[model samples]
Target: MELKKSSSKQEEVEEIRTIEKPIDDSFLITWESPTDPKNPKNWPYARRWVQLVIVSVFALLGPMASSMVAPCLDQIAERFHIENSTEKALVLSIYLLVFAISPMISAPLSEIFGRRILLQAGNVIFIVFNMACGLARTKAQMYIFRFLAGFGSATPMGLGSGTISDLFTPEERGRAVAVMSLAPLLGPTIGPVISGFIAEYTTYKWIFWSTTIFSGFVFALSIPFLTETYPKTLLGRKARKLNKIEKTLKYHTEWRLEHIPQRKLVAPALMRPLKMLTTQPVVILCAGYMAIQYGILYLVLTTYPVLWTHDYNERPSIAGLHYIAPGLGLILGSQASGIFIDKTFRFLKKRNNGKMAPEFRVPVILLGTMFFPTGLFVYGWTAKYHTHWIGPDIGAAMFNVGLMLGWRGIQTYLIDTFIIYAASSTAVACCIRSLAAFGFPLFGQTLYDHLGYGWGNSLLAFIVLGSSIITCSILWFGGKRLRAMSDMVIFKDE
Candidate 1:
């Protein structure tokens, strides 16, 4: 009897080997070879980019809906006869609340069922309920519709990182992750700009209707093109096909020939993001820093109106234009960081004698740590002293640039570190970050009111500095030691 060596670089080979029986050759099933074109990592660059665009579009729709209603809150309140400020805000915050909760369920399902079904199905749910939000006549109805739509919206956030991992190697994922990660941060900034004009020129209902229409376009476009990328799910399908073609007298199904761990919640195929959150230190720090960055992004979204409308005496439509400042920052940051993160990773890999670790991703965030607080200080004091409007706009752009750079770095690091469970790790990160996005704005008005814009932003800047130091230090200095201890990590080296 003879044995063959599985390819060194193939994930499918690694998965099959993990579950291979030493004594029996009868049970093993795997990809035909390292270069199997069906393997998503082996997919042509054009096809991979198509998947990235589709997934990124799907991911963009969620946050677009989340913040699209921001400029329309007043109109919504007037129509619903709502008087409480908190209740008015809940219409937006409740969506984020559900966004946090639903991913715990969706991420694990992506692991089992594959990415395409969950993503498309989730978009359908978002489309249906988001349109309902436009039709709602009462505050309670608005809250319910928004929450349900958010449940569906969360699917992309939970699963998109894992899809990038599926299609690209660690060396190539940095740029792909940068584009996908930009959607969530950039969407909120761009949302208010669109909605502000709509609310000013037409009915607030158009905001919801407009987003639903765009989402429908995205949903329909994705149907024929998007395909499954999960290796376990793909391999299982391959095994089932082989079993039928070979006409095996003794047959075994994918359920019994498992190469991945299973955890059941309400369904046998479902797993929990909470399990990953509780156990992984890399996830903890990555999610925490991302959360802080997310919280700051939303807080800025809330405060932009105050600076432009009340302080500068601009109309709603005009004030909305300020969002472009941050929007430009996000685009610039993503493009610049995209090029450098991959270069940095390859450089560090060469230095380490062709070994690569997730820690290489952490250095990019050093640029973020500096920009994050400086942007805040500049924005805060510029607004505080009533300097030229361009001064604050520049500051806002700087802040957004920082947020996105950090966001892309942390997300790529998590996907690389927990390669097999990228969805689960990303799901937990979404859970924490969504909570921050929800909670931070609830206090934005009060924080700015009590301390004034200068001091309040300075406070946030200080916190950003502190958190970045703690998170980056742990990852840069101690990440390898921690990976050695973590069972959850899959690509321990590359």
Candidate 2:
């Protein structure tokens, strides 16, 4: 009876979709009216928020999988009989390696297939492989399973920004993006905190199993929660429907251009992120900047266990609780920054007589830079001297405050700058940041071992300070000029 009612309801929707039209020659299939419910942008507040919540949840789970095992590394090393430090870290960073490459594929595939299918499909893939990680019999199995799970993880990271663009106008995007960005940003820091007590009390295998359980719940929720938000795909569906009834009806899009074969679109679309990374300085430089910040974050997270476990002699569960410091910073910073971002944009636009641009986000980002290195410096020295635990935690919190501010600003800038191509552009940024995340922790143990807490962390701080200042300044003063020069962006101040 439930199935019958659902099938009948679905048929009713299909009928409604086909109802509108005064057919004519060369009519473009678009929203029947500005208020059309089929249009994602026109969705009600309750529905849009539901979709956003689902995307954010999906986004969080992948990153959660990446780091939830942090407190259980010793157990994993024992089980796998791993001796080499690099290889041990590889067990953790290996997932991120696939995160770097998979988005380049997933983003383009979403462009072709639409966002809903790929995202839901990604959840299913993640569920299967993540479950495999729990049951792995060897190091080889662990590495291979982790690497495959990351492909599932990459979908939401790659395509989430495009979904935001689809559902909200530029003026309404800042808060939505903050919600989007906060999920993945805080996932790594919070994952261990949640899993830490579990690891202390139970087998490390629970990490993967519990995660799979949570993810399966999320996957069930996503089946009905998500919808296709890509405009081109929506319009294409409309065109197909109209064409079915009228034999002569033909709707045109860039995809239907005579010279560019349908099959050829796939290759260029797949390569678009790489092209943007190489040819566009704003993209490459901003991506590089974000990469540095992300690398530093993973470096700190991987090495944090060392600080507490060895130096401070804290239990694994207690050490896990310390992750809350950075996690809190992300939450507080994102909340405050989210509100200010839209207000700043609106203020800057008014001052410019109703002109709006990505550069408006630069001021908030600059404020973030001041806080990150300072946190690193404080965290380094406090740990080096073995001061009260609160000191280092305080510093960690401060650094993440800076991180949230800067990362959010850059993400919003990228979305605004590449609205139409947001998925591809964000994929480029995610690729670089994921690469950095993968490589950074491999050297984290070495950096701290050789230089000790103070100098090693100080070295990282200086690097972050330099990169943050240079890239942010360039984005502010010169971003407009660069955007004007890019073939992809059509900039108009007026």
Candidate that would win on TM-score? 1
RMSD in angstroms, all models?
3.0, 6.9
Model 1 residue 126 lDDT? 95
Model 1: worst 10 consecutive residues (lDDT sum): 13-22
List of clashing residue pairs for candidate 2: none
Clashing pairs in 1: none
Runs in model 1 lying further than 4 Å from the true structure: 1-27, 245-271
Query: Candidate 1 lDDT, tens digit per residue, 37-127?
Result: 8778778899999999999999998998898888888989999998998888888889998878878788888877889999999999999
Could you tell me every candidate's TM-score relative to the true structure?
A: 0.93, 0.92
Clashes of each: 0, 0
Instruction: Name the TM-score of candidate 1.
Output: 0.93
